[model samples]
Target chain A: MPNNRVVNKTKTVTDVMEEQTTVAPEATPAEEVIVDTAPAEMRYDTVDIDLTQSSETMLYSEVIDMGTSPDNYVGKIIKVHGQYMFFHDEMSENSYPTVVVLDATKCCATGLVFELEGDAGYPQEDQEFTVTGALDYPSSEDCPFPILKNAVITTE
Target chain B: MDKLAEYLQYPFVRYALIVGVLIALCSSLLGVPLVLKRFSFIGDGLSHVAFGAMCIATVLKLSNNMLLIMPVTIIGAVLILRTGTNTKIKGDAIIAMISVAALAFGYLIMNFSNTPNLAGDVCTTLFGSTSILTLSRADVWLCIIMSVLVLVIFVLFYHRIFAVTFDENFARATGMDTEKYNLLIAIITAVIIVLAMNLVGSLLISALIIFPAISAMRLFHNYFKVTVFSAIFAVICAFSGIIISILAGTPVGSTIVGVNVLAFAVCWSIGKLRGTAA
Candidate 1:
């Protein structure tokens, strides 16, 4: 609820193209809403682990760990800042929303996959933003990487 | 200091620092003997060979290139150290030939490769290293094991290596198998060179191997004293370099080497004042 961007509605990647026109924020379905429905134990009731507080090197290193060492991060309330990216895989017919953090060299990249809450509008590609959520692996077969579930996106 | 403490809590950062120290200790340990024997250029030559081997491994899409790289570099080191003296081509000439050839051939291979980030891949492997902080758990373990092996061998044969290093013909006349000791030094140097390729990139690895020994030699008179001082100086410079780079966002290889250069200057100044510099 703090600096959160109100989304138009629940628009999955497949339907995102058809609904290109910006529509007014509409009432979202109960099942689609994550912030309100996600268990209060992790995201809602607790203060998130703030990643933006650290330097870029520290932040990038931690993000790399989430991939190499996943169990340590799962189900934890987390907050991070990075450039937003959207990937469309034609062979798998899947679209993934991700945030990328750059290392000191600015050559190598470390990224985190994020899933927005229901009714959240998609941010523009490569836009810098802060996202907070509980780290989880969803049931979707398209993305094998751990994604931030019930996430709230705040664009700078 | 506070910022470094905060960064140190992360596992990856800790891993990087640990590997950095171990690799520095190993390289500095080998640095004294190499510099004394005039085999300092061997580190650079073998590193270029490693780059070529790595490029080949990259082209083949091997999951881990260490398997291909380690043996190739070892063979190259043995060949150079053993045959350089006996052959007409000679030590420096043969090393120079292999060095330039491997580097050019590696770049050419990389130019034709299908890697998505060709420039980035080559750049990371050529200059200040980016792989040190991004290493997997297996890399850390392997580095530790290899470093321990090098240290153990160095400690066990310290006397023999010292004899062969200071005066090879005298050592041979004294009934020591000089060639066997030379071979041991070559193998150990090759291992450190390969590990340093990850820490400082292939191009700058010689700095890691030679700078500390040279710096220590500026002040110390005895071989034992110089070797100990070099090892200590290298560890301090390298560890501080990592901490500074993490806080300052500088490249790791250059930062470590920069610290070494600064330390060398300071030692040289001290030696000049004492009238002891060689």
Candidate 2:
């Protein structure tokens, strides 16, 4: 053996890649999301609030004597807690935007201004809807608030 | 001859026969155009409106003055027809509104009123049973004369009526006032309704208007042929229904309506089969 040549074998990554490849996993069925945070005791009150407020207006708590009294609002624009400002309307404590009193009007009762909503149109609360209607005066004792008449919606 | 002798024995029975034939003729004749025009629902609506008027009359304790119901019913029929022609509210809507409202008003009057037998009386008028069998001589004569008047008018205005029924627009284009013709039809229909209320009762009389026309339509294609055929068919059904009711002791209105429905179904089936065969 006059010239014993040294044999050299080089292994390349591409040569072994075709035999072993990664497979993506199949998609799983989507699950429904649930969000229920309101307590059981105040459910009826929330419902009342939702019933009173118009579907167009948002609910806001009126601070009387620093949270001693929470007044419901509808159709009137008001500021809430320095962060959010919306139309304050009466809604039940349980239901969102539930209109407690669909109609109401402002009157001085026992040295405090009370808004009595009239019962012309049923307005739900916590829903965003723009109402272009006129203010109505008290025509009945049951509801003592101004009403929106010939109201057109800009958005819901 | 024996049956005729029997039917003629009671003056009231004679009256029923005379009144029934007249009503069947009048209704069948006018009903031809109405059915052709596809305004058949008018009969039902007008009848219900007439029923409402009858209820009102009942509440007021108008016994002999029950004839007051006719004018009110006619007025209501005219109103329904006019409103039905409006572009804003369709004919079907007007028919539905008038019928439901009239029935509702009748119910309200019956329920709220402190009158005895008012509800029963209204129910009788509505279903059309109690009125027909007990028709007096005067009612029978009135029905006959009214029917004759209606028939004469239809004969006189045959061409215009046909034109209006076929194509109202073309009728108007040909210098025939379609609105007048339509109003005439409504008025005639109202009068017919009041008359038929005495024969078939208000609730079941519409079948008399609709069935004979439908049966005739199946047998004949031409307008004149259909009208004649419808009258004949109506007479047969009326007589047969009465005879069956007498024999079976069933309600007259139900018997009549049942016979008409059966006849219509048979005719319709035959027509359908013939069409398929052709």
Candidate 3:
């Protein structure tokens, strides 16, 4: 018989299957999904630019070079070094951490705005930091500059 | 130094040095006339107007801020320079009012924005910043073109510029278009001030146009010598300042201005020794 039934072998009607959740229940524990937890090199996006080794001021210049052509940096893991500032301007609202380099006047600062990979506690602001992340652009209205997403930050 | 060589290898560092040098040369040359005419306040007033225009450009989310900053500053310079006794406000009064108003308005507009780096923006606009190190290829080209144009105009009309600076009435009597020259200088001044905002920022920009001119005046008596010397002097100050800032992490604008001040002192001392000091 075509329908020789085993313990949960009844095939649902094609019409009914289309309306249900596509993921079928797995009977075996081995069928559980595992998240990809690879190292940065093992991941699809490779570290293209590593600024961690650069001197503090050189890092600022390199960041500016990256800022000029943000589109070219997409999905590329860039490691930048700078003084970190916790971007919790409106404490009640969501915010990202920033690594900053002052402008020519030494008054204004421009840097990579970064969203962390997980809900990790941030360090004290204004410390030297080396942040690694994939380049991401925000909506023009939100920020005119490019930001780093899924970033991992380290501090000295 | 090894550190200097390391920094120089980067393209951005080279760009900063070029722009800094060009700006030094142009501003120093023009600064002689402006300082002699007691019109150095024009630099400050025009720079403030530039800051206001920059704020508007930011609020509008314009891709290139120069589009707005350039025209507005030019217009302000013309009004401040050309509108002689016709306006109720005197030239100095107009400059004072406009500079203060524009600075206040700029601050007001910026305060209303949701920019995350509000303090940084204001400080960068008001004080000098380190943005010189971060210029794009396009910005570098624009600076080069503007510097070349300014240099060519100055070279072609060197004699006339000297004549006009000394006596407007005499220049007019000699069938020279003094008003036109004044307008040209005003527009140029406006452009230079705006460009300088990228160097010393809006507040300290006057140093570029004022210091080298005054310093060179102390060292040289002839107009041609003063012009040449100021250009050379400004370039040295700017060049050394940039290197020092890069090596030691000092504020670029202030360091350049400080170097100019130091140069002025040295020049003044030499002038005193030569009995040129009045």
| Model 2 alpha-carbon drift over 4 Å, by segment | A1-156, B1-7, B112-114, B276-278
Ordered from best to worst DockQ, the candidate numbers read 1, 3, 2
TM-score of every candidate: 0.86, 0.61, 0.77
lDDT of 1 by residue, B26-140 (tens): 8998999999999999999999999999899999888999999999999989989877978888999989999999999999998877886787788778764457877888999
> Each predicted model: what fraction of the native A–B Cα contacts (within 8 Å) does it retain?
0.32, 0.00, 0.53
lDDT, residue B56, model 3:
84
lDDT of 1 by residue, A14-49 (tens): 454333322221322334432222232334566345
Task: Report how far off residue A148 is in candidate 3 (Å).
Answer: 8.2
TM-score of 3: 0.77
Cα-based lDDT at residue A33, candidate 1: 30
Error of 1 at A122 (Å): 3.3
Model 1 chain A scores worst on lDDT over the 10 consecutive residues at A20-29
* Candidates ranked, most accurate by lDDT first: 1, 3, 2
Question: C-alpha displacement of B251 in model 3, angstroms?
Answer: 1.3
The candidate, 2 or 3, that scores higher on lDDT is 3
- Which prediction has the highest TM-score against the true structure? 1
Provide the lDDT at A58 for model 1.
63
